[model samples]
Target: MTVEVVIFVLMGLTALGGAITVVMARNPVYSGLGLLGTMLSLAVIYVSQLAHFVAAIQVIVYAGAVMTLFLFVIMMIGVDVAEDTAENLPRQRLVVGVLAAAVVGFAVYLGVSQGFDWVPAASGEPVAEATNGTVQAIGERLFSTWVLAFEATALLLTVAAAGAIALAYFRRRRAVRE
Candidate 1:
């Protein structure tokens, strides 16, 4: 097998294992660690695919900032307490199982219909332009085309963070009043 294939297989397996660990682990901290592993593995895969900018963002934004936030939330919520496993909704497990099965079935159907050939037939197109998958290209597109959407997303995140702080402050105030 080729080196790229080998690396892809290893990274894919690591990502799959991490995802399984995240789902199966009962402890919130362990689950967060698993998620971190998954994100890091995905970043490696992005690097292998020559998406260096995306890989850096994956590591910095997801594995760094997002995972830290997730772990902080877990710690703040009291990691010593186990999650309640009792089903509050009737047939919730059954409904979730059916939904999962449907999703898997649809994925399988799409994959089969699209033919699972990994490598595409080569077109006469030129390969490896300097602009391809570079930080410069990404910045150009982000600022030129998607600038408004990016600004909107930033505003949304700021609003969400402010809302969270407001909620926490109000909760603390209410508890103090009590």
Candidate 2:
């Protein structure tokens, strides 16, 4: 086999294996590490596909920054916390199973019907294609063409942060009052 083929096969296997480890690992820290492995392998696969910029972003954003955040959350929550096996709502599992099956079925239907090619929705004028993977070109495209989407995403993230803060404050207030 060609070197590229061998790399793809190895990276693909690694990514799948790491995903399994992330799901099945008992420890949160181990799960975080598994996620890191998966992200790194995905970055390798991206590099193999000649998407060097995407590979760099995957490593820098997902493998580095995101994994660090995951590790911090795991540390704060504690890796040694005992599992609470009591179900709050008894039929929660059934509901979740139904939702999962529905989602999977819909995904399968979409895959079969439309195929998996990404069709970007350009509300305004169609976005000009970038010459290369330079940050300047990406920035130009994002600001000029995808400005509305960028603004919406920023607003959504800001609202989410505010909501989380509000929830935390209210929970703390209630605890203190009690």
Question: How do the residues 98-171 of candidate 2 rate in per-residue lDDT, one tens digit apiece?
Answer: 99999999999998888665665435642455335545666787899999998899899999999999888998
Q: Which stretches of candidate 1 lie over 4 Å from their true place?
A: 116-126, 140-178
* TM-score per candidate, chains pooled: 0.72, 0.56
Report model 1's TM-score to 2 decimal places: 0.72
Candidate 1 whole-model C-alpha lDDT, 0 to 1: 0.87
Note the residue pairs that clash in candidate 1.
none
* Candidate 2 residue spans exceeding 4 A from truth: 86-178
lDDT by residue (tens digit), candidate 1, 58-176: 99999999999998999999988866788889998899999999999998987898775665854565376735576778988989999999889999999999999988899899999
> What is the alpha-carbon RMSD of candidate 2 to the true structure?
7.6
In model 1, what lDDT does residue 157 have? Answer: 99
Residue 82 of model 1 has an lDDT of 68
